[model samples]
Target: MDAKLAQIREDREELEHLLSLAQRARVKDMLSINLRKLDTEYIVTKEKLDQAQVAVTLGQASVTNTPVGRQLDANPVIKAYDTTIKTYSWDQSDKFVKVFLTGLGDLSQVSPDQIVQQFTQHSVSIRINQVGDRNLLFNIHHTGQPIDPKQSYVKVKSDMISIYLAKIERGRQWPHLRASDEVTQKPIAPPKIDETADPSAGLMSMMKQMYEEGDDEMKQTIAKAWSEGQSKNSPF
Candidate 1:
């Protein structure tokens, strides 16, 4: 992803260089291309960063040792947190839009209202501006701050219903749009098995099926390997 992002930046820079020539077409290209790249992340990144921060918090609170918990001793600042959140967001948007488009049951379920709520209710700052003609048509701004997860304001209460509808409509028409870079990352699920739970479920499931269905010779081979192993726990 970093490579991809760098390549895009390089391409964008080339376009910007052309703009120095004062060519109308190159200037238009520079504006159009750069806006698309900007638009892709402007709104969604902050939302995703906030969501990821909550996840890290939840993981920290969990009884089990997790990546975040293990790294807590590192005393990471917000800067260290950002790249992970960005990666999380990129993967999420890719998977979500891919799957969503594959089986688009109803755009209504996409919930633009909920998205709007993120902004209006929680003081998230998302701005949108339409820029350019046919060559460079796209939203100019969609950047925002993270909403306070604890807030309960209703600034977009009346507007949300229609706003949500607009989101769905836009989503259907332009799955890869550089429009409202909305965060579609599912919050990490609560742990099903924690610090004290049966840690062998993962290895047990695999080994159990292998043994029960194995021929005698294969079972003997597995037993030989097992005798040298038999781990104290499973990591799943």
Candidate 2:
């Protein structure tokens, strides 16, 4: 999955370069279409990888018990001890979003391996094992904005657990910490493409829709690429 993602990213860069340099309308549109497809594939692949890793980690956690030589508890009453950590503060800088989980009771003393955390693009789950009488859990199913799972990390502080979420796009401020905190309207879906018709037309329509829905930086990128394609002569 990692190798596939790397290939997709490399192909995207090449296509983007061709799109910027191509003078002919047909060639530019074709490059644009493939670039969009690559972007979609990369996102889907990365998400699957994240989920798979999380599942493996959870499985490992469940199977690990006392050493083989140690005696086991006879008919151990497995009391469900999952305490939801609700008291948290969040702050963001240009590059990272910081989440501080409070009331975890001196996490600095706990072993790093005892803290189980999983990160996805839009969510985070942190489980602090053997914390007092119960396991402390801090979970967000959906964040206010997307984060880079690969670069994000956690730090155990003296009084709390600090989560540093690397922003996918730098300098984009989050409106709220969680998606549920704000009343957000559902995003409009792109118009369905008709395969029977000219494929370039469908590609152009999709590109226009993306430009409309994207952020300021995204809009600038598309506009610049289009402008460059129009002005430059095709090297090929």
lDDT of 1 by residue, 1-236 (tens): 34434543444343233223222322233234433443354334444655677677756656557676667645633332211111111111211211111121222333233332333211122221111111111122222212223332222222121111122122234333222233344422211223232324422443455456545653554465555344523443
Candidate that would win on lDDT: 2
Candidate 2 residues lying further than 4 Å off, grouped into runs, are 1-80, 184-236
TM-score of each: 0.23, 0.46
lDDT of 2: 0.67
Clashing residue pairs, candidate 1? 112-164
CA RMSD (A), model 2 = 12.2
RMSD of each: 23.3, 12.2
Clashing pairs in 2: none
Q: Name the candidate that leads on TM-score.
A: 2
